[model samples]
Target: MQQVFFRLLGPPEIYYNDQPIRIPRRRSRALLYYMVSTHTPQPRERLMNLLCGDMDDESARRAFKTMLAEVRSQLRNIDPSIEWITNDEDRLTFNPLAPIWLDTEIFEKATANRQSNLSLAIKLYRNNFLDGFFLKGSPDFDAWAQSTRDHFQRLYMLALQNMAEVYETNHQLEEAITCIHMLLTADPLSEDAHAHLMRLYWQTGDRTQALRQYERLGKVLAEEFSVQPLATTQELYRQIASNANTLTQPATPLDRTVHPPDPPLQATAETPVVEVRLPYVGRVRELNWLKDQLLGHEHERSMLMLRGEIGIGKTRLLQEMIEGYCTDWRILHATCQEAESKNHYHPLTEALRSELNRQDIGRLELYPVWRAQLERLVPDLFYTGATDNTVDAHHNYTGFEHISDSSATLLADALVALLNQLATPQHPILLLLDDVQWCDKGTLGLLAHLARYVHRREVFILLMYSPGSGEQRLAALRNNATRLGILAEVELEPLSRADIHELVTLFSQLNKPGDRRLHTIDRHISGDWCYQQSEGNPFYALAWLETVWDQPETFVPARIQEQVTIQLGQLSQNARHLLQLAACQQDSFDLAQLGSQLGFTLATTLDACTELITQRLVVADPVTTTSLYTFTHKTARTYITGSMNRIERHMLTQTASRIADPEAIS
Candidate 1:
């Protein structure tokens, strides 16, 4: 499936798996939006009037045909397989089941599965439908858009209100406070929202803020309608103020309380020790599944593909899962890298060298021929005096030598046999291949061979990769493994709200018995801030937590910047330039307008955006669609913008401003 995304929430956007296609002409965009919104057949005359109100039948008909053609052509340019618009001579309708991703559709369908989708629905309602967009002259279209926007706005408000109540019921005062604040932002006259927010502020131990919120509400009411807050709100405010007064008293002067400092003790033989372990959170199910396999009586080899976005904590989770079993299990871990992808068996060689010693396993009676093949990977088996013959230095593929098909098979068999030796009943093997997408074809060949014997062995294979960045390299292997039921993929998603809180709480109090923490005292507030900054990616969340709040620039450190640049390096010059320009805009920028300023054709812009979008560097700005796209991650934008020299950055920003009204620039 191409995975079509008809984004109608903020500003109109259409995506076919990261390829964003926009109808260049205003009338065409308007026509497409109308049809897509209605999803019903429209009489030819209705559309004609919308576009050419005063034209003769023939002239209007010609105009309508041309507009429709442009829309169809634009959609076709991104993906030809999907017919976005279908019509006969009579009327036009959207293909609803072009198998799409629409937030409105998701919200509608969430009724069937309320608890699970409600949170998603709430997240998707970032702003009013088409928050700032207007079809200035098309009155009918404007009316339709306005009504539709109101409908979604009402749904969003209702959803947020319900969410706030749920949070309050669960005693999540900070979360509830956030929801109520959003509710008021959208509907400022909401008395219930103000009341809930005031109560929530009190519940969270902010008595001063609670009283201040009441004042703010009073001001808003007076400004809006020259009226006071409801009697109920005033009474509640009085109750809070009464409690505050009761709790406050003149501070009794401390009795010159400079208690004599305790005499310094003599130094002991050993300094008081405080050992701190790195904090871990979430992934209960994934951890339990691996533990089940580890503790089971029978071992049916399990090949798990752990995939997620970068910094989603794949490696961290792996460490947590394997830590307790280390004493009994022979855990061998190797990380494949992009630079060494072409080096034959590089990952395996590293793993073998780590776990197997030449003086130990290598000296054993593996078949004479098998031992020789193993020697190629395990260098210390035979004393070569530095005359390494495993790779031909002269060959283009320098690190690994090619062998006959039979010999490659022998090498795979030899490694499998070696693993069998290392693996014992008491010590089952856990072979971890991190960054599997970077694994060489040679390693894949060995893995394919090993997979056959794995089903009966006491070994588990975990291949970890990021789905967005390098998945395309192993699509065929992943597909085959899926069909064979040999590979099970467990995706590690971002932490939930509850999970984020747990994570923040655990680490904030690390190595402190008295609950003296490195994080801010209000755990709930700190968790909320972390969620906003990191979006629950554990690595990012932890990074934000560790950073000084005022020095926010340190959150996305140099390593993350290097990794971001590595990803950008893989894109074409067009894509890189487009990304640099988009990054300069701070948030989303108009793709068509930005490209036109740089003399980039629509096709060129789409091609570049498609690459960035698919790689998860940029996305159709999901915050109230502005027909603009942004760097998908805040860190990516931070890195890219910070990479440019100040003069270059300023120049690019000016260039991006040109897109605000390309016509003005023209």
Candidate 2:
């Protein structure tokens, strides 16, 4: 028979062969109380103190020895062979290793079992810890005692409810009903317990009993708590009442319709940011080349220059590389926008601030920290502070002068210092500077300084620019950098028709067969259209598509006409006149001869070519130093020649004839 582990969260009691062992002497029980309550093996010295916490040391030790003798006599009645305690006097150790069961341990194990296996968890919590037991004022023992029972009761009730849910889900109506009954025994007023009982009653074809339980529960709540049954509780009661003969269909789905598939999302849906994945279009080969350049090169400080005309897709190439090719590298990007009319170093400021903020800068002083960087990008910025409304000392320091020659080097050093500080540890930095042509001289100088350390540090600098606009500055910088061994360039070409068609097919949602006319337009026009309208520039093509796509069904031709008219209206008078003269002549024309034919000054002709190129109406030989230009697209040439009036057209031909042979018109 196991001796019951007695605790005095209340007064002490014992069990032998599953029966209580009554011991009447209160002081003898106190000795047993101290030993059982504390698991630590108490020494003779500690036991003496427990027996008398405040008596003289000698008297306390004597009293504890006498109490131990009494406890041994009581234990002898259970069995003369039963030895209740063991002691190692040499080590001052006492240990109780007998087989005994404690209510607190039972309660805890039951709680754990309930979580792992509900049935066992429920059985273990069949009754409160030694029901009707009590111990006055040993607060530590009392709190531990009551807390264990309370936790067990809560867990047992929950276990019964969960078992009911599992049984109901499995259509085990009788078992589920039995589980709820067990729950009601423990907590007769648990609303959920009753509600689940009602559900089980209906499931088991006992609708009358289910309705009766509901009424009983409702009355209990109203009389005891002054509250009516919840709507769900009432609805469920009504369900059971109406369905007298029908047992709940066992095969019915227990859950509601599968939640609609969550909308496809990247990262958290609450964030407003969206990322665009650039498609691999016509630049597969260049992309491969770029991949090789980025991947095969292990050395840091490698630089790649993508040089092209304004609309020629330099930016797109870099965007593609970032999305598809350069996953292994850490890309930090800054784009120079034509919209920003502030100082040249403004782009650099935006870039620096974005990277710093992305790195989560916390409360940094601007004067020496950010100001030092600002000085490098705009040296004159250091000289001018708090000059304009845009320059608030606390928010920013922007009153600097234009970065002249004297401050350029100082600015470079500051920028280099800032970059060195910003670089993340152990990561290769790929600095992408798009539209480098638009970058101010100060920013350009900073980039030049960055290039100097590119080889030494773990950094790759990629710069994309238009040769027409940036060639001179780029050449000067490259020539200077060449002496230091860091100059390279790559050029982009127009996408072939097949590639353009494939891109439209892949990116645009419009059905190809349904919108054959538009498809035909795209097929015929996308190839040379960008070349002609945007000098084969990807940005212009994308922007132009945004304007012309999805024309109204009621006015398809009208939409096309409107678009053409809008673009024609935007043409400068000089470009319109020169385009008309070129239309009367041939597709390709010498600029000097065209100027003589139009009876316009060479400067006027040059300005007209500039307008056409700026508007992307024509393409010039990007490799040539001269102003030799041609119609960028067949449509532009055809539009001008086909739309010209007869009289103005004849005058253009005669002007061309006279400009070719001076004696003819004279």
Candidate 3:
């Protein structure tokens, strides 16, 4: 399979396996270039006009025929085994599946994925299209080349501006300055770039240079456009001059840790490898508290409820605590997924089965009554004559959802007894249940039951869940545990800016030494941007870092976008669109009015709201009588709104506003 790649963001070039393929004749090369760039068949007349328009019609026809043969001959020079050209009567086309490569193909594909690849797209523009490459007596070809050159330059300039904005937002002043310089180099009369350069210099403490930039902008505008700099630029210059004595620069300047080694497009042979491990940062105190609860100073068992917002590092904290500090303890862990939330006692049964298979519980002399209930959950753990019904030796443990009230009691009691027998101070039992908000009703019940005896036995139960996930049964269990004086709720909070900084440092150090993009990343991605972009969530921080690693110039993580996409994907298309429209609002929206605007019944809207809330994508606020709905997180809402087209969003807002009065407050 010969895959073709094109690179035409600069001078035309074709290569495969690092070997350049050439078309000897200028007009023939232009024919191949035209086909690759436009991906369309060329008619005989069009090709003749494009390549030999100065000659007589009969002579042009003969010249075009000669050029077509030359092109076919040149195409075969690379690989004679392949049919690289297709001629159907009068149309000339490149074989679609031919082993051909083009630089322009690479540029277009890289840039097609939004701003995420703008940096790579910008780098591909090595020079103007077909720089200094022109054929004699081909006016149409020259005209096409000039037009293409302008088109590519405009794309390159736009990409540079986008990169500058992203860098500016991320507080990478130096990188932003470089982008501005690139833009000005391409279009010296750009007043906006000059103005930005002035402001950026002011931020960098180059006050005198900043003032000079304004003067430079004025001269350029007067020379090119016969006008003065815009009033806004003049105003900015005045402000900088007037406040020179008391101007305060931005905080967290480019320190040694946040500095770039070289500019963009520095040639290097080695692929930059950023080694990333599962990052664990700023949970020192929480880890200690958890360890203290599990490995009590007084040898008393503890049940700690680890709660936080989604992606606040609950699961990470649990893993760190267990793997880093509790190697001596017998650990049994089971994570609950949303799909398994209703499978009776699924999480608890998993944890028990895990530990039981590791150790011989038969030697502990478990009671026949308790063992019988245990056998239903764990395969092959029964005595000679346990329950009335004989147990299958190879029975798989799927919790019985239809067990009687008496049977439920025995099962719960049997679970607690088995845990008690297994737990000892010498080898404390650390039973970990992650994402307990997804636990079944039976698992929740058993957890609540287990919580009561936590202080009495040597077992430590750890429960992790998101507080805002709307798990009512889990909430009830939490309340009951609090009343019983057995649960110590440990709520994890988002990381601070300092913590984000530390995390980035940790990530950078783990990268392969001499990774050139290391400093480029350090300089651009300040802790401030990470803190603000991720809202101090480590999960999002890691996502941002990973995005930066792939595209050293990007700050918006596709991972986070993919997550939001997956979250939205769980809803019906109509429901997702409704949610996106709702996201256009800056505050809670009246559900009834929203439903009315979307032509949905109140009941149907209510069901949609319930689904969104259940997914934790939206939250319902209480009004006097009616409930208003809002997205749970501003980030998720922003993502949804940002994904919507500007015109669509505007129309949605206009339609919504027309249906309701703005001054109406609850």
Candidate 4:
């Protein structure tokens, strides 16, 4: 059994037994590309719609049959032993029974296994997926081809970026420079790549060339976005201009160790452990509002939903509430895990277990019925010693074993009673649930139940989750709370520019006072750039700051790319793909244009967009028409664009250029 080698990365080429086989006819080639690229059993109707969309239904069916026959004929000529097409009553698919190796598959595998096979991955990405294979008269197929091309291109570019980082880490300056230059060619607006090229030029004793790169960056930025280079980029330019000779020397790793003197000064008293505090910036009113709620009247139970994007600092606000305001309250915090979303009542169970561990309860004297009910949730809470004389000590835990079979309402009521028992007039109970989007259904239901009755008790519940997460459940919870008139929703907005500056200043004071890098960052950093790049999100800002703190000359795009990639990794595959396409267009794009470019129907595209909007990956442009959408942050667009492959980018540019000047294309 000879294996057929199919290459879709460059030209659509095939080989059997190490001999080249031509796949003749553009339609036949398109059919093969569609099947191999999607790697799914495509419905007959979908194939007809994509490949023969221009034809009438009857004619399209005839044309589709003819194309399939041609495809099979081509495959047979390549290798008679191979069965390439599998057609059922309603679907057509590539036959996996035949021995075959696809370059696209191999490239994807290598890129996915990037850590171990970086070099192989870079080498395997010979060209974009099905390069230059346009299907005339089939707009849908063309759009699909363009999207697939872009996907592989982005993967290849990522491999190159990774390779460049590896080379630079290994001190291969020339190789690293080459990779940076290649990246710039694919993504000219990559500020980090431009900065890297400049740095590499300076490191290799070409001050003149390094300076020229800065001029190039200025021109590009001015011409393209009508904005100046980022403050970090400008700072790098100034540093190189002022100390060209000093920078040309090989960069020495900073000495991070501090050695104690041989005869250290004698300590008269124990050194006080000064608690470092990150100055709570921007949410003064919100924080004060929460404090008021926490300190409200005894009969008032408050349920506050703190909603924001992933890095917008809802957790930090929760922390501030705990440390700065809710000192007198007994805090029980539990964060839901994505992997544990299916676990029944996980967050509540963990919170109860934590509370139980915090307060050593020898017996359940106060609420024996509640104890028996909660024991079903956390059985270890009811453990007793033989010598113990506390109330209910002689009662066997087996008596509550059937509590697991109790109704959800009964369990929720018992849990509420247990919470009430824990709360006192002297110390209120503050229940903090973080990442509530990942909360188990049972836990959410319990929270919803509690929300209705919490106002009657001395409890303050703070539920924090990214907006659009657990939409149906959260919406139902909110609606129920609203109907009861107890729900208080507080949206955590991104930090203002001034707030980010204050945050940076506070971070510097607490962590690295008088550090030269900190001084430089304070002096030259652009508040607008920071705000835009981080979307005023503190987590992303802090991550970027940490990267720059270590290497003051680190390019901004690289820092942003690292953070954005980490975020994108957390999204569903469909949402991530949609975001990538949205990013390829300008920051703001017409919704219809995106759907057309991605070859998605309006409904499918809208569904993906809804997910993206919910996750805050992209937001609807309120000022613009409802059909227009924009990324949550400019940095996200930069990261997405920077990650695109050359061919994918070229296709986009070509499409735009053709649209702009139809005559120019001819």
Candidate 5:
């Protein structure tokens, strides 16, 4: 028996006994491709509508029947013994048990199980789905085909990424480079793939190639998106450039190549610590204020809230303050993760665990009763000989019993006592909670309790969170702390253009001494363009500068545009659509104009715009007579426009262009 093979990844084709079989009609080929790709029973009416919707209903029915007949006739001629299409009264499906192979099916199966046959999957994705096979007058079929093409492309890219990571981990530098190169070819604007390729080149002892890759990435980004590389990517490039010689140097061959014996590990009381190394750029005043409050003679306990936008350096500032000012204090730090928000008292539990692990448990002698109560929170602390009898019987009796106010109060008091027992006047405690916006309600309540009693102890609490995210909860906590004279709020503003220039200059001087490249870069660097592009956000500025600094000419890099797109991708579909519509209005668009174009009410538009403002994607003009808003950066506007397909852009542009007459409103 001869096998039948169908190729649908590119142009649809079939082969019988290694001989090509002609698929005569465009509609017949499309029908075959759709049936094979979907691999399920498709309603005959739906298929007809998708393929021949532009025709009259009777004509479309006839076209669909004729197309199905042609497809069946071609299959039967190729393989008379095999059942190809299973036709019924209302639906049509390809026979699953037929002795036929499809490129799309094989590619999908291989990519789906890519962990085992990633190389094979990568090889099987020969081209885009049904490449150059457009059914004229069939918009629905074209749309479906385009979407399917994008899906398969993403899968292929993911497979390549996975293969690269695996190769890099196994120290297969050349193979990793090959995989990343292919990924970049598939999606040239992928900053991540470019970064990986740069790193792989550096690891393979090719410093020049690494530097060239960065330069090429910047050039490509500039040409394609009129944007610079991301600050993170630029920073990586800088690191590679600065340590080129060190990175490229070949390792000395070992004399005997003897494997060293595994050393015996000693048990220690200290938990391993992860040090955060963020560049300390701005926030001098904030740091100074925190230092004074933390180290001042005022005996009252203080709570300082460091609030800012994401990547605006709140966490970095906190880390710097701890290292610079809180050296003499015993610090217990915990970061509330977004994923673990549902875990009650998560941040508090982490802080307690870290503190307990750092200290000798035998030294602190708690009352048998308090020890048992503490065990309720930290079960592992007394894991060896602890009993569950400490749990209140009444609390556990009802399986879903709500924690009573008194029980919560008791738990908070026990937590505070544990902190007090660990701290003294000689060694004050600094409890640092990072990303407090994600902290659970129970953790916030515990902190509130601690704030009320903090005046009696030498402990200082530091909470860091993005301002807009946890507004209501943080405001409530702030009010309580303010009433107690224990709260201080610090809002971090974006760096001034001069400040950004200073930061860039400092980094360049430290890393690339005596290099004249800074002079050329600094000329463009001191302009308002960089400041506006970055919105004075240090992270954004750094990212923008790193990519454009090498080139004397100014152009927006791909990294900057991609970053905005990535941020937008995280928003709700409605919010994202609203912003995209807003982008079509160009610079400094009025809310009324946008609402008019979208056919949305003024209030609904305002609500969506508020989300965009909070994200720092757009900024409302404070001095405008009308309600004017613009994207925070031109790069963002460009990114939004570039992300849309031709049809979407045309539709949005036409709608926005029609709103020439501004509506007057109160």
Candidate 6:
């Protein structure tokens, strides 16, 4: 005899001869549900319509055939005599001639006998209907499905109350009280949960707190649900309040085992392969320093915060750090999004998820620990059970409360759990947070908290942020470090001439190593070139060198001059107008003042500064007394003054003249 059962309330466990089997796929499961729900054979067209309401005839027929074939294969495996197809003209019906034990059927049959079978029915309907199957915009189905689903939910609640009732009848106060707490956690708003908790509290000799729970529930219901307690719940509350005497009796044995239905089978998505190339030259000392900070130490927690202006090789430096340092550590990296900043805990969380899914720590014995930690980072991700969706859904984080809170104490706890599980002498943890400036508040707070205990633990966290951020904001962090005396700072300055030369040699593919011309150009680069033009910034210098090398013809001084001139010359007229306004004041022009001076729109002024950055003419120093644009090369500032036409020069001077503090220096 085949014993089929519906367990839909708790963890789903299926047993066939005490062996576990993978649940059948969706189409097969739906077919089974339909077959069990209907007494007669469903018409072929009707089945097709239900499965594919608007698909063309061929598609619907194909889907219907596939589902039937799958259903037949599964049933045949379990019982060879049971078949899905018995053709009656053009219609199809499932032929289950033998007696079948269906969960819903048993539930209905048991519920018919209120006194004896209610507990059995409650135990039978454990989880919600079709636990993991989502109905797509089918209102009628949703309504009908919800009614049945709620029936199970209601019965489960009653089962807990039944436990309480039986325990109370036996005067098993402790057991009954435990059930009440479980009910409350499952549903804080449950009137039954509140009433049961109140009764338990009173019985436990906490009568005052019990009365408070009632008062709290009254206020909560009034403000939120806008309703009084149900008559049955109120009666229970009154009975608890009125009675102080306890009755003692023998305990009744009750079976609490429940099995929720199987969840959907998930497919793992492909992960993007991230490749990093080590720099040919620059910051060798910094690279070694990073290695020491991240990998050299054997026992202490470590952290490094990489900070510099844009195009200053911060990212490149980090790439080098990862490549050269902490190979033994399980490294995880996440990047922040400018657009996603408003969304809060978006890209950071998503990045963490992607890194987790891509991890191949399967054989490391620390896999379970690592997985537990990863799940804490993204609880919803593991539930998907497939890589592609796991990675993709994280990247597309929808800003749910569950995901946002995952990175908090919960995430920390998970990480600690994972670490404890691994407890390896060799393996350590390394996490890199990119674009710290754009990180959400929750992530920032968690990191700060982690920083406190990270030294004691075997973890390293590295953060990279844009320079020139407010002192009030970042300074406090540094001050805290000093006060705690547990943190260190490494500031990155621009590359030296020798460093730049090494970089040029590393990236350069000159015809001859002994080429005098290459040497001549390298020699021409004085300290001023890096300090001003490159601003000691490696990326800026590299971009400059590349731009010079990519002329229409071979590199010539004339061509280099022309290219540089053209880039400096193409600033929007309004941008130049704003720049002149900025230059006239004490090196900084407030947006309103610049707007009024140049008659330039706020959008135009902002766009012009962005263009200036692209042209490498100005930099947006995010820090300092004022966040303003400045000439990339001081020499370029000189040219701006020298090359201007007489009228333009006069206009700039005139704009400068009107300011209260004309030379508004930062």
Evaluate model 3: give its TM-score. 0.50
Best candidate per lDDT, number?
A: 5
Q: Which candidate would rank higher by lDDT, 5 or 6?
A: 5
What are the per-residue Cα lDDT tens digits for candidate 5 across 178-265?
9988888888877667777888888888889989999998999899989998776787788897884543322111221222222211
Ranking by lDDT: 5, 3, 1, 4, 2, 6
Per-candidate local distance difference test: 0.66, 0.56, 0.67, 0.66, 0.68, 0.54
lDDT of prediction 6: 0.54
TM-score of each: 0.52, 0.44, 0.50, 0.52, 0.52, 0.44
Cand. 2 Cα-lDDT: 0.56
lDDT of 2 at 264: 24
Please, what are the lDDT tens digits per residue for candidate 3 over residues 484-551? Answer: 77778778877888899998787777667676546657667677766767777776777767663445
Any residue pairs clashing in model 4, and if so which?
none
- Candidate 1 vs 3: which has more TM-score: 1
The local lDDT score (0 to 100) that residue 266 gets in candidate 5 is 15
Worst 10 residues of 6 by lDDT: 265-274
Runs of candidate 5 with Cα error greater than 4 angstroms are: 1-279, 299-301, 358-361, 365-370, 385-402, 455-457, 513-524, 527-529, 548-570, 661-666
Off by over 4 Å in 6: 1-280, 298-301, 358-380, 384-391, 399-408, 415-424, 454-457, 469-486, 509-532, 549-580, 583-650, 653-666
Point out where model 3 deviates above 4 Å.
Answer: 1-275, 297-301, 380-396, 454-457, 468-470, 513-519, 549-556, 569-578, 585-635, 642-666
Off by over 4 Å in 4: 1-277, 358-363, 366-369, 385-406, 454-457, 508-516, 549-563, 570-574, 622-626, 645-666
Q: What is the C-alpha lDDT profile of model 4 across 451-484, one tens digit per residue?
A: 6655354777788777664655677777777787
Q: Which regions of candidate 1 are displaced past 4 Å?
A: 1-277, 292-301, 359-365, 382-399, 455-457, 511-525, 552-559, 589-597, 601-607, 620-628, 663-666
In model 3, state the lDDT of residue 657: 65
> Between the candidate structures 2 and 3, which one is better when assessed by lDDT?
3
lDDT of 1 at 593: 68
- Of 3 and 4, the candidate ahead on TM-score is 4
Model 1, span 1-666: residue lDDT tens:
666677777867778769787667777877877776556556677777766655788987897899999988877776688777777677777776666677666764442233456678877766766667666555555545554575566556667766776788889878888887887788887666777677777778898998998888899889998999766677788889888543221111122112222222111111111123356677888777666655655545457788877777777676676675556777666777778787888878766544554455634545433544665565343322211113321223322465544346556767777777677777878777877877888887788667666534477777888655456777777776667667766788788878888877776666355543463435334677778666777766666565445555534754456567667887998888777888767566776666676788889987877778767787687785568776667877887887888887888888876665456654
* Local accuracy of candidate 6 as per-residue lDDT tens digits, 237-267: 5665776465222111121112122221111
